[model samples]
Target: MLIVGLTGNIGSGKSSVARLLKEMGARVIDTDQVAREVVAPGTPGLQQIIDHFGTGVLNADGALDRPKMAQIVFNDTNALKRLNSIVHPAIRAQLLKAIADYRDNPDAPLMVIEAPLLIETQLFKLVDQVWMVTVDAKTQIQRVIKRDAVTAEQVSSRLAAQMPQEDKLPYAQRVIDNSGTPEATLQQVRQIWSDAIDRSQAQAE
Candidate 1:
């Protein structure tokens, strides 16, 4: 399988690219969704988090209070590291299992693991290639503020917590510019999808 690690900075439209890939028949594994599942109520992942960060991170509905947890860790590097220590291993195991399941599926020529922290968390090591989605900083900030309904300061803080987009560029084998309209972005995705299929078929031969 041609396993691609799909990643981008906040508001760079990584999910949009993943969606387009899914529409084109690639099996896409979204790590963010997997992360939430691992920490859902009654899971060992949730229990580990509660044990470390306390019950304040839980909602009244017994689900994870994600925003609350974000507030607690976003500014604190040690706290963030601690949380990752608890969560990333569980996520990695699940990702490996998903990849294995899809590896033999002839229908899925491409497997995209969509992770915002693909490089930071070293998940890129598991993929055959890295496809990064990028947008200008101004557009990125505007998109994030609008999508998240957060103040500029809050968005800046979240951005600061992540590795800068420039630093990640060197690690990417392909970069998808997402600063244009949805149609433009879709065109880029289609081109990449076509090339990826050719590469996969060549390797199989």
Candidate 2:
């Protein structure tokens, strides 16, 4: 299978692009979802986090309090690094397992792993290509504010915590410019799908 690593800065609509790729007949492993699974109640990942950050990081229902955790990490570089250290290994292991299972299935034609920190975590090395979704910073901030219902300052802080979009651009082999209308973005995705098919055929040859 031709594995594509999909990544983008916060509020860049990477999930929407991932869904479109699914519609084009690619199996997508969303790392965000896997990250949650690795830390669900009773998991070692959760225990490690609690041990490091304390029980205050857990919600009343005993689940990881994402908002509180975000606040803690976004405000402190060391905290963010510590959180990534705790969670990234588990997420990577699970992602590799999923990829192995997909490789074993004959029906799996294409695979994409949607990871926001693909470059930062050095996961792009695992894929055949990296596809990045991008938008203007202004558009990114607006979309984030609307979707997350957080203050502009809060959104800015979250965005600040990640590698800038400009820096990530050079790392991507392909770019999906999502600053335009949905129709325009869809056209770009279709082109990528067609290119991927051609690449797969060439590899078989």
Compute each candidate's TM-score over C-alphas: 0.93, 0.92
The weakest ten consecutive residues by lDDT in model 2 span: 101-110
For candidate 1, give the lDDT: 0.93
Cα-based lDDT for every prediction:
0.93, 0.91
Residue 158 alpha-carbon offset, candidate 2, angstroms: 2.8
Residues 1-205 of candidate 2: C-alpha lDDT, one tens digit per residue:
6888999999999999999999888999999899999999999999999999999999999999999999899669899899999999999988888778877883556799999999999888888899999999889999999998999999988887789999999889899999989999999999988988888889889
Which residues of candidate 2, in runs, are more than 4 Å off?
none
Index of the highest-TM-score prediction: 1
Instruction: Give one digit per residue, the lDDT tens place, for model 1 in 69-144.
Output: 9989977999999999989999999999988888756468888999999999999999999999999989999999
Cand. 1 TM to true fold = 0.93
Q: TM-score for model 2?
A: 0.92
Number of clashes recorded per candidate: 0, 0
